[model samples]
Target: MTYGKFAYVYDELMKDVPYDKWVDLVMKNTQKYNIQGKRLLDIACGTGELSIKFAKKGYHVTGVDLSEDMLMVAHSKAADNGMDIQFYQQNMAELEGLGQFDIIGIFCDSLNYLQSEQEVLDTFMHVYEHLDDKGLFIFDVHSIHKILQIFMNQTFTLNDEEISYIWNSYQGEFPNSVEHDLSFFVLDHKSGMYDRYDELHFQRTYPIEIYETWLREAGFEVVEVAADFESVSPQTQSERIIFICRKK
Candidate 1:
């Protein structure tokens, strides 16, 4: 979904997210797998946080996202940091004209935004086509257990002078799916009033085995499945599931 005004406040809302840990995860996996290449693609890279981090680490990074507004923010951030990262506006499932990369990532549970299983598989195939042979493909998703046990029927709220939001999560039509309804109140300093807006987002995820099967069908060899930021297999109540695959 297009982020709309949410793009402007995205970074602020995500200020506490562990972006450094994600970068470290990629670095650790690359080293462990003995993969040698500098080219990296960050798909669904919201506002270029991870892309900028990767660029700082000397990776030739390209950031791609479906929202023009998000890409605009990413481009501005990259330029502000004196970085030369290519930011593209494109759907992950229909990736095109982007050259091959040593690593492709869809972090931050971005793949869950896809509405259908076919979309996920199509994205995997396109990612495979854009990856170098034996290149790594890394992504994460909210685990089914987390979706059911935590997100479903949950309400979360945040308050700040500049920004405040009420987030409601409801069980979606499909299994392992949740619809996020968010309402934001941002203070207009000059007017001394708050502007309100609402955003709706839908996300779905499958069992780990289904993801592995789709990766195999797209000609990728599943290398590892880790939970959260750990290098161990996921437990029964793991919140996030990370998959590391290699183009074979």
Candidate 2:
């Protein structure tokens, strides 16, 4: 459950990600479905990046993540941008008491962190419970192909002005899973000091059919499954697969 230093540098390392595409896709779905309510809940909204964008689009946004450090950074960013976004620290699998939302989103492969079929089903059920009738539930996960082919034996590195990192991916001890061992060297600009931190994260994904089955069991009608950032069928070689569902 430790994000470690990656919790601090997550935004910087992911700066090149196409967050605008996520926003655009969500907006497009809202328009296509005639979803007019403004309330939105972003599950696993790490650092609240996409939540801020939704808020800018005139939606009342609430972001929930398990990491307090990430929530702190999210709060700072919201303050800096003069945005009124509510951030909560909670586990998605046990989320409760949050009133219904017109739309709920889990993006950036966040669902993979559940690491187990039961947890995934529980999370989906909770999401279903919290969504208003006929509401939209949009999420994306790393395709099984990506997990087996690209991430199973990958080593990636990133060097930046504030942080340098070595991310090593290995086959997980569990079946159909991957583990990430991340080492980060962060610099303190004012004090001229460097800090080293290590973190272990685990992610696992099932086939698209399994996800579809679980969504249906959780009271959602699968609306669409598309390639990442596009409303098209996902190819086998695609890295990410998106699922768009509507609550029954």
Candidate 3:
């Protein structure tokens, strides 16, 4: 999806997301692993939230996302924050032109949007190419168990004075996948009416073994597998799985 109108309201809807937690994870891992450089590439960095946070922490941050509208919003946000971050409109699976980075991240389960194994592998290969030798690559995904147990066949609703939404998730055609159907209502102040917008988003994830194998095939050394922001191995019921890898 292009994110069109959703780009405008994305931050408002995601206000509760723990962006600082992601930054802390990166910093903690960097210190633990003795990573020295500060150059960072944030893939699928929606609206520059995490990117800005990273920049604030002294990293030279660059962000990439597929949606032009999202990039537009990201650019405006960076400008308003007096940050000099570079925002690129590019597909993560086909990354190019940008120089290498000491750390590359695809946080917030953004990798789930890749529809095929080939796309995931391609993204890994490109990320490997764009990383400095021995550089860290950190990412997270919605665990298969969570997709099946929590999202599939689920309906969620949020009601607020300014904005509200009804979200439904259904099993996708692919294994360990789910399709989200979202309808949003936003109050229009001057018109005294509510504007409705509908969006469909698809996400898929593979088993942990599959991800490890693909990363190895792309010349990366799988370092750690953490669950739900904890520095521990994933459990059967972990909703989010984090992978830490290093380019070899």
The estimated TM-scores of all candidates read 0.99, 0.96, 0.99
- What C-alpha lDDT, on a 0 to 100 scale, does residue 53 get in candidate 3? 95
User: How far out, in Å, is residue 39 in model 1?
Assistant: 0.3
Superposition error at 186 for model 3 (Å): 0.9
Model 1: per-residue Cα lDDT at residue 180: 97
| Residue pairs whose backbone atoms clash in candidate 2 | none
lDDT of 3 at 10: 92
lDDT of 3: 0.95
lDDT of each: 0.95, 0.91, 0.95
Residue-level lDDT of model 2, residues 40-71, one tens digit each, is 99999988899999999988999999899899
**Cα deviation of 197 in candidate 2 (Å)?**
0.9
Model 3 residue 39 CA deviation (Å) reads 0.5
How displaced is residue 61 in candidate 3, in Å?
A: 0.3
lDDT of 1 by residue, 41-118 (tens): 999998999999999999999999999999999999999999999999999999999999999999999999999999
Better of 2 and 3 by lDDT: 3
Q: Which stretches of candidate 1 lie over 4 Å from their true place?
A: none
| Candidate 1, pairs of clashing residues | none
